[model samples]
Structure formats: C-alpha cells, structure tokens
Target: MLRILRASGLSSSFTPFRALLSSSSSPDPQRGLSVVFFGTDDFSLPVLNALVEARDCDGSVASIEVVVPKLKDPSAKCTIESVARSAGLRVHVPNRRTTLKYWGLPGAPPPGGSDGDGDDDGEPMEIGPRYDVGVVASFGYLIRPHIASAFRLGIINVHPSDLPRHRGPAPLHHTILAGDTTTAVCLIDVDPTAFDVGALLARSPLDLTTLPDTPFPPPLPVLSSTLAGTGGKLVRSALRSWNATLDAAVDQDRLGAEPSHAPKVSKDDAIVPWATAPAAHVLRLHRAFAGSFDAQAFVTLPARRKPDGARKRVKLLELDVVAAGDPAAGDAAQLAPGTIAFDKPRKRLLVGTADAVGVAVGSLQVEGKAPCSAVDFANAYLRRLLGSGFVV
Candidate 1:
C-alpha cells in the first residue's frame, strides 16, 4: 500500500485522508512532481489523505505541498494543518500581503524569465518549474485566470455538487434546501471560465431525502441513508478516478444547469420564526443549516406573568416536532399559523402555522439550561404564566 501510494502523483490539502497513508517502509512515491494542496475545513481532510494514499498505492505521485488557512473561531481550536504537519508534508499558511506573492513581481517581463540564483542582474527571476497540477477544496479564496493557466498540468477541484447546478459558493446547504434528491461529488477543472466546466472526471449523487425510521442505517446503504459517510466515500472515488485520467474532459449538459446560490448561513438564518412557519418546515431548515448554521429556531414566549404581573420573551433552540395529538383527521381548531397550543402536563408546545401544521415540541435549550427536552424545558420554565392559549 505504501509503495503504490508513494508514486501515484497524489496531492491534496484534505486532511482526514491520512488514513490512506497509514503504511510505511517503502520508497517515497511522491518524489519528483510538484503537487500543491489547500483547504481549511475538516471536510477537506478525506481527500487530502486519499491523495497521499494514492501516491503510495500507485507509485506515480511526486512532491506534495499542503496549505491550510488560519481559523478565526476560538472554538475551532483545530484544523487540517496539524494533520499535514504530522504527515511530514510541506505546508504553508497563505497571506498575500505577507506570505508568498502570486510568485510574481509586478511590472516585469511577466514571470518565468531566468533564475535569480544565476545572478540575473538583467533578467527577472524565473519561477522554478512549478506545479504540474493543483487541487483545491473549501480553501475560501478565489483563483485568478492567469494563475489557473500557470500550472503545467491543471487545477482539479472537489466541488460538493453536480456540475452546472448550484455553482458558486454553497452547494451542500442549497441542495438540501432545494430538496434535491440527488447530488454529486464532482471533480472539476478549476479555471477562470467558471467552475464545473473544465470537464467532469467523476460524479456521485448524495441521497438526502432517504432517511429511515431506525437510528442507524443498516447494510447496503440505500436511499434514506444519512449523507455524511456516503458523501465522503463518493468524494474519494471522484478524486481517484480524476487522477487516473488527468487530461480528459467532458462537455456537460448546459441546459439543466441553473445557478442556485447559498451564501454561508448566518445567525439570522437560524432565527427559527415561530410565526409563519410550522414545525416541519422549520425543522428541515434547522437540520440543513445546523452544522454550519447552528440548527435553531426562535419563538417569542406566550405572555408570562412577573411578580409584578408582566410579560417577557424567551427564545428557544434544539427543538423537535412530533405528530400533534396523534395526527387526527379534521378534528382540531384552526389556530393562526405560528400561534401556540399546549399540553401543559406533557410540557409540549404546539405551534400552528400557515402550512396548517401543529408541531409538538421535542427537545429545547433555553438561554441558560443545557439543551434539554420540551417536557423538561417547560416543566422548569415555560409552564409558569404560559397561558393555555395564544394572544393572537
């Protein structure tokens, strides 16, 4: 395994792929070619590991460099850079103003002139033969066209969706929100023209709507499987396949390609609206955006009495919607959408909505308590002065 990986021309900034490079005692396969990898998120780890593994497994890879960004979140506390360092790969954090320039000096005869090592008093420094190919995923920077054409091979990217669709910034969240049943791990040509156009080497679809009643998805991972594991595996396949055929290109269907964009979900996106939204719709929104967006919904509490007999608002999170009163058929009052209904003894919250939904609250996290259940939540908090009905 190590021998094959060492020579497979493998490279990427993804970190989890370290699992692939777990073998040793072999000639280093990544010996001669210049390969660069960059990413910041853990999501990129698998591909990064797979690239290293491919070099060992196939014995075709050359030199590899890894790049990771500095994280702003104090809670982030960790990154793929440590993984790259552990693997003994060349790694750098890029800061254009301070780190490496575009490897170019402005107002020169373009780069690639002659060696500064040769005492080039008259000529500019020629960039040493650079990167045969480059791979990028979730690195959070834009690649210019001039840089795109500079690679001896080309830049291959790991985009989280199928080509021509969900192009630009967000793919995963957009796919789930659009309720797309199928998505892919696409290997794309990273060029100035646009992403998803350089020619597709591999495509694998993600099954989101296919969830099952069981806690664990058993066996031959079918429709209804949670996508995390499957998506990672599919991405690995696409990267490996694309590596095997470096020069091939496939013109994709330009017609079905409608650009739907998802900017990174913000704290505002997580403000679960108790008005105008039923629990089911709100639930989906939370799940889709939760990991990246902190799956949460906001609701103003029903009028509560103070010692002075006044009202205050309480926001909620970590909630679930159960079948309201056992899914009856036309046997309920038509509360205004976003109105609150109750099962006080059960500590249940039933929120009505424009969609004609009455969702039973599952779990909840208040401003103070660790995230807990609605029953536990209300028993301790909401049940007091929480009217049996809504002000609306």
Candidate 2:
C-alpha cells in the first residue's frame, strides 16, 4: 500500500507490505529508537540535521550518534564530523576500515575493555550496546554483516534515486545526462551484499513543476540539494512511524523492472565529443557537470604553430545552446563539427557540433591559465588561429 504526504511542493510516499507487520518487532513507543547515523559529505548533511531535529522535538528518536570515516585532513570544511559536533552529537571514528566490522555501538565500553576488546588485527571480540537501528546516507563504506546485525532493526539508507534504477555512486549526474524529467528519493533497507539493491521503506518524488523557470533538467547541485532535503523529510516521517514503514518495505525486484546502473563520473565524461555529439548534448554535459570540481566539459584545440601538432585543452566554464534564428548560429552552421569561431557582434565563442545549431561558450579556461570571458580568450588565443585552419 502507498500513502502520500505533500508539503512545500514535494510529495512523500510510502510503499508498505501489510503482511510483514505481523512478523516484525516494533520499537517501544515510550522511549523510541536509538539511532546511529552514518554519513560523510555535504549530501549527508540534510538527513543528519533532520534526524537531530527529530530527536529533539519528539519521542520518535530517543538518542542519536554519528559515525564518519576518519578524514584524510582533520581540518577540512563542511564535513559530517564538524556538523555532528556542532549539534552536540557523539561522533565515532573507526581506527581503520576493518575496525567497524567489530566496533561497539554508542554507550558501549571503550576499546580494550571486555566488551570492546579486539584481536591484534583490530577485530573486536565482543561488540556491544546493539542500537535499535542504523541510518546511512552518502556513507560510501559497506557495513559488514556482523556490524549490520548489531542493530536490532538493521540499517536503512536514504538514496537519491529510485532503487533498481541508477543504482550506483553517481545517480544525480547520470539522471541529468539522460534528461530524466522525473526523479525521486528512496528510503530502503541496506542490503549487506550490495549497494542500492534493497527493500523500499519510503519513496518521495521531487516536484519539477515547482521549478518552472529554472534551467531544464536543473543543474547538478540544484537537483542534489532538492533531493537531499526531500530525503531528509521522508526519513523523519518514516522514523516517526518506524514500525509501519519497515513492515511495508518491499524488495526492489517487486518494485520495478531490470536495474539500470549509474556509474561513477570520470574525467573522460568532461571531454566534449564534438565530432559526433549534437549541440544539445553539449548543453546537457554542461548542466551535468556544472558544479563538479574535477570534471567540467573541455575541448582540445590544436597548437597554432607547433611543429609536432600539439594540442591544448581548454575547459568550458560556461556553455549554452545558440538560440534559433541567431546570426551567429547561422554562421556556425557553415563550419565543420569541432570548428571554433568567434562571434564578434555578440562577443561569444561558438563551437560547431554534429547539429546545425552551435554551442556558445560564455566563459572558459585555457590550459594552465585563469578562467576568462569568451572575448578575452578570442583576443588572446583565437587571433592568429581564426582563419589559419586550427579546429578544436
């Protein structure tokens, strides 16, 4: 059965199996559930903050603790540890990855005690506390079976995509690249064996209609923040009615067809494929990687006067499709794909694509140089190569 709750232009829905409730044990209503949350980055913040808020206002959450990976840099900004500490929540850092396999729960004795003593390999002999449940969001590490079993109700994950589809690390990026019109946040049981192949506790669809004037398919950071906030709300609702939602959870195989994967984005995805890609595709790439720190779309320009025909990589900092009937678009239509030409009247740098319409580059960064406007780039680099047969 599915129940819908709407707020702030977003809809939260639950898919629960009535039959499972009879067999499952429910949390005590008086004290609520003791939750240990696992998360790491910016995407994890909303959910973490939501849990903290819920713990304070209602009895649904009795106490909350956070678990984060040991940061390579302790002073890094915007991390889960900092946020958790600010909220006055107890934070746990495993000595190493393997330590979690036998680590104790919050309220358990410190390591080296009878309840927390581990083997020489850092594998604890006796894990303790056994919290009511564990919540994971954007926590990349897999929870081992022993650690998962330590929680009475097991662990639940707040994933950004609907399970059984886009089931990997980079769902938001892939969703924009595919131009998906609809997307949702899923609350699922954490399958110990794999990622995102879990039972659904709740699913919430983001209302794209709310963003009528925003860029089509919305930029990556926009979509991510929207979904993360929605996921946090859904989680709060689920925890408040923990028993009912958990019992209603259904397997991914029952929810949809064959799974489609959203693989991790790499630097290669940033390399513009001008030879065969249309201008619309370039626009999609720009949107997909807009806020990405490492993988912004770029074009390779052949050296202007190099004897060995070397090429320089220029990162496309900002891009847009040329409007229809624009004179620059008409002029760019005459050039071959990958050809680069400056639009003097508009002060724009246009690049030819597989389609007749071209992509206009608003800002770009030449190799080893600071980012500059299209006019500056044209003056500094395109002057000699404009009519000299140098194509991007």
Best by lDDT: 2
Model 2 per-residue lDDT at 310:
50
lDDT of 2 by residue, 3-79 (tens): 11111221122112232244456788778789999888888989998898888888788889888876666655348
200-246 in candidate 1: lDDT tens per residue?
55556655445455211111122212333333454345444433444
lDDT of candidate 2 at residue 382, scale 0 to 100: 75
Worst ten in a row by lDDT for model 2: 1-10
Off by over 4 Å in 2: 1-22, 97-129, 207-212, 294-306, 384-392
lDDT score, residue 126, model 2? 30
Quick one: best TM-score, which candidate? Answer: 2
Query: Which 10 successive residues of model 1 have the least lDDT summed?
Result: 1-10
Score residue 305 of candidate 2 by CA lDDT. 77
What is the lDDT, from 0 to 100, of the residue 193 in candidate 2?
47
